[model samples]
Target chain A: MTIKNFLYVNRKAPYGTIYALESLEVVLIGAAFDQDVSLAFLDDGVFQLTKGQNTDGIGVKNFSPTFRALGDYDVTKLYVEAESLAERGLTADDLQEVMYEDEDDDWAEKPSIKIISRAEMADVMAGADVVLSF
Target chain B: MKFGVVVSEGPYTHQAVDSAYLFVKAALDAGHEVPRVFFYHDGVNVSTRLSIPPQDERNIQQNWTALAKGHGIDLVVCIAAAQRRGLLDENEATRQGKDANNIAEGFRISGLGQLIEMGIQTDRLVTFGD
Candidate 1:
């Protein structure tokens, strides 16, 4: 099959609901195929990338650590909407530093989360061949 | 155009399955191809044969089963999600050492690759969720 752009739009928070974790499972599984896969963190989805998510008290599995493993899966484009972060009173500092090894750039480590404007996020959405929301 | 659908919510708790079923029906009536419908999260619960609702209300699982049988569409419930929520087919039940299985007719347990494949192969991918 031809490689298609699979944009996974995450709009929910990490723990309070199951959408975030469910979406992550799809992303990890989708990485097995030969396709252009990317993730968009908007709304409360940005919370999925925040650091030190301890879920022991809530009795839920903390799957936030799995985001770091995305880089190993070669699914690295993580677009975080700037407006979403601002609206939630979160800055880039509030996000976890997920890094990927740039294969073409001498295998250098680079940040996966690209904080972009709302306009750019819209363009990213429009340019996708298939947009999967969760 | 070919359409791919995802039902991510359960039957009565949310209207996602209903809306997706209706959308698929409308698409088929208009002579469009709907090859697959992937069920994830609580949506996987839609594949249980044991779900008995009020006699007056609509039978959600049966509707999907019949529609899939007529159209030869794939009704895939994610294995990971199914396992977590205790929704199992006979084979899965056997493999997992369970006594019984509740997978409805015309539905199968599969992986998320099917969902990704649907996105790649179909002209459009539609999601019905909360």
Candidate 2:
């Protein structure tokens, strides 16, 4: 099987609809296929990574933790758009620390999320073989 | 280049169908090959044969039907999404004990596996949604 570059674009907030959760579902499944998967958080999608997300009042399952586990599935290339974060008045400190074990170095865990410029995000999108946007 | 198009919104209510149609048409015009167009979420509604828009307005279902007919493209509606939205095919309607089937011509109800297959098989998988 060819290892295609799959870019899963998240442009929606976490709870209003099922898109965020479903998109995460696809990512988990896609990872099992041994594809090269990367995730981009932009626009309202930046909210998905906000720390201390509580769904107790919303009645929906809190799926924010799932994003943290994406690293185990080899989906560690998370790109959070800087412009989106700035527009939302957020910084890297406001988001959860998503990390993956680095295979090259005796399994030392490394930060998986990368705060990238919107222009850099565009280049990332252009380089993808397949882009699944939600 | 092989293109896999995914439409995830219902017709009229959103511009996803229109954008997808135009994108597919442009891709075809540009000599690109579109092997499949997968409809998911509310997009399953796009395959319903029961929709009757005003005569003056463009028929979204017919537009997809004609595109599929003209290019021999595979129009697949996600089975789970279709079932939730009541867009059943003959087999599905029979299996579910439904009274009728209303899947439009050129559109077949299938599984989410098809969507994954498209991503793996095609050169590109472009999604249009709300």
Candidate 3:
């Protein structure tokens, strides 16, 4: 049988080579095939979702804007690692105006985008039919 | 099976290498074939033979070397990315007027075509980057 559920883990920054962007594209492709899909961001991967990313200084277009379109691809289960954000001195407020607050709130109930600790992440990975980390 | 690997992070001081190694081992153990392991941007460093890690730490280059030697896996380094980073084969090293080549054996220096090929042949493509 075709893999029913796929988990895509993105661990890169938003700019530079298209690793983050391209991984999201692959997730969308999987979703289009009628597969259950989710995404987890870790390490610098959390930076990809941060708000107010200024890429113009580097002579590159700001790619963070595209992240807002993920919902259209049916990729709603966005996750961020709590430790990575803290290490980078970034709170949910520092990110683009998404539901990042729920991400940092460990006590929040049924938050749209939850920030999970590394230990809590194992179950998320264990449940996927295929797990792709990028 | 379909496989897609997106390696975006550089090879130095990063978990991208370790993560990719674990995933590849798991995939192979699960009896899945990795059709494409795309090394983009800084990931092209895995193809270099000039890496010299601290003696105490595990050499990332050697891990890749062992993977290739044991499995006969196809390791393709992005040509454009490698050129940008000055990673070249023995022939390209000479042609580019460089003193030496650092691309290790068992790794082919190729282009994005290899990625597209993997997408076509495998059931899934797992990426390791950043």
Best by DockQ: 1
Report the Cα interface RMSD of each model, rounded to 1 decimal: 0.7, 1.6, 5.6
Candidate 3 per-residue lDDT over residues A1-134, each given as its tens digit: 24355677888888765667656655655555655777898888898888778876799767777666665565667778889889999888776644322333573433336788887777888877666666
Q: Best to worst by TM-score, what's the order? A: 1, 2, 3
Worst 10 residues of 2 chain B by lDDT: B78-87
Residue pairs with colliding backbones in model 1 are none
Candidate 3: residue A106 Cα off by (Å) = 26
TM-score of each: 0.98, 0.85, 0.53
Model 1 per-residue lDDT at A98: 90
B1-130, model 3: which lDDT tens digit per residue?
5456666667766788779877887877897766556776678887787888889977777887788677767788877678878899987888889998888877878865565455445666666654
True contacts kept of each: 1.00, 0.43, 0.14
Query: Per-model TM-score of chain A alone?
Result: 0.97, 0.98, 0.81
- True-vs-predicted CA distance for residue B76, candidate 1, Å: 0.7
The residue-by-residue lDDT of candidate 2 on A1-134, one tens digit each, is 77788898999999998789878877876677888889999999999999999999989999999988988898889999999999999999999999999888998999999999999999999998888899
lDDT of 2 by residue, B33-119 (tens): 999999987888999899999999999999999999999999999887788778898998899999999999999988777887899
Which candidate, 1 or 3, has the higher lDDT?
A: 1
Q: Is the docking of candidate 1 incorrect, acceptable, medium or high quality?
A: high
* Tens-digit lDDT string for candidate 1 (A1-134): 69999999999999888999989988988888979998999998988988888999999999888899999999889999999999999999998889999999999999999999999999999999999898
Error of 2 at B107 (Å): 2.0
